[model samples]
Target: MISTAIHCGACGARMEPGANYCSNCATGRDDPNTRALFVVDGTTGLFNDAFTGALVDHETSRAMRYKRPISVLVAMLDHSEFIANDHGPAQSADLLRELAEVLAGAVRDIDTVGYLGDRFCMVLPETDQAGAMVAADKVMHAVAAHQYAAGHGQWERITLSLGLATVNPDRMGRQDLIQSATLALMDGRSDGSNKVHLVSQMS
Candidate 1:
């Protein structure tokens, strides 16, 4: 008969036969695949789309269960596509990385920051619409104030268009919240980027 016993992938502890995870180290047997589920974006070291969606789902459920306010912020670089077209993908990606760093610095430690494609998303737990607006304003100001180091000793300025959506008495799904924020972001872009739009104010 073939042996089924294996070692823990994380701690190298011996695992019992037919075990799904290690008893001694508590490491999962299928950790390689499991870890892939939470992989970060290689460029920015932020949560990728799959992980971001999962996080949003988890946070939304928690907020609904606990009656806590949760806010989602979606931010896009102003004229990012234009930048890519004019400056090339390398410069555009560098700008994204710099902006990601600024965003990571702007939010509270409790907040979750992730990337949804080229756009940035932040999930703020226990935050209402007002609080989210404040956070959004801070991020906008920070990005506006930051000077990115362009190539050849030249500096460049970057701006963000942000959208914020908060949980309310009417329950909303994770995707719905994201969509609302996206719509608000689009509105901000239409009004000219470097602005923050609140979904609550849209209606």
Candidate 2:
């Protein structure tokens, strides 16, 4: 597949029935093979950017309509450049794949985890700011507890930083939520990696 976007009408993230994509994705909308390739990141088996964005937007709209809390978290593997430099770009990608599994395991089943191009994003439904922090801690601890095989049977522990944003119906939209999470991620990274930041903490 050439990696072109194919969004579905039902949810905007295109997929076919029984495909290895998100639950709402496989709405029997697009060709199975094409949908799978378009929606999934081949390396990590997570939703690709186009599909993830749709999921985010969908969740945001739902949260807004129902007056329920929803949180979005943006995370990045700390010192990824160092990992790439020390090992190779492939190794860095492998580490990311491993991290993706950890993230999948750490969050609730209802939560959606995806690769948003350069970073991993988690969309948490019914999760407010406090719940988001708890989820982030689970992810951080889960990652810290696991070790990745760097090379030559060498096990290396990896870490990450997370930024969180909860939808504020009064003032926040999808873009605002994403930007807040990105800013929070930046704040945590600036203070030194392995931290979780919130937009409210921004000085």
Q: Give the root-mean-square deviation of each candidate in angstroms.
A: 7.7, 7.1
Kindly report which residue pairs in candidate 1 clash with one another: none
Model 2 lDDT at residue 28: 42
lDDT of 1 by residue, 1-203 (tens): 99765877766766657866443323467773343433478777677776676667766787887777888999988877667777787776777787788899999867878888868999887888889989999999998888887521333777889889888535544445777898988866778878888885422
The residue-by-residue lDDT of candidate 2 on 1-203, one tens digit each, is 69755556555654434444444543444443444556788778788877877777777887778877888899988877766778777777787788889899999967878898789988898888888899999999999888776432333787888989887556544455667798878866878888998887321
Model 2 bad stretches (over 4 Å): 1-35, 150-155, 168-175, 201-203
Model 2 lDDT-worst window of ten: 25-34
Give residue 145's lDDT in candidate 2 (0 to 100). Answer: 89
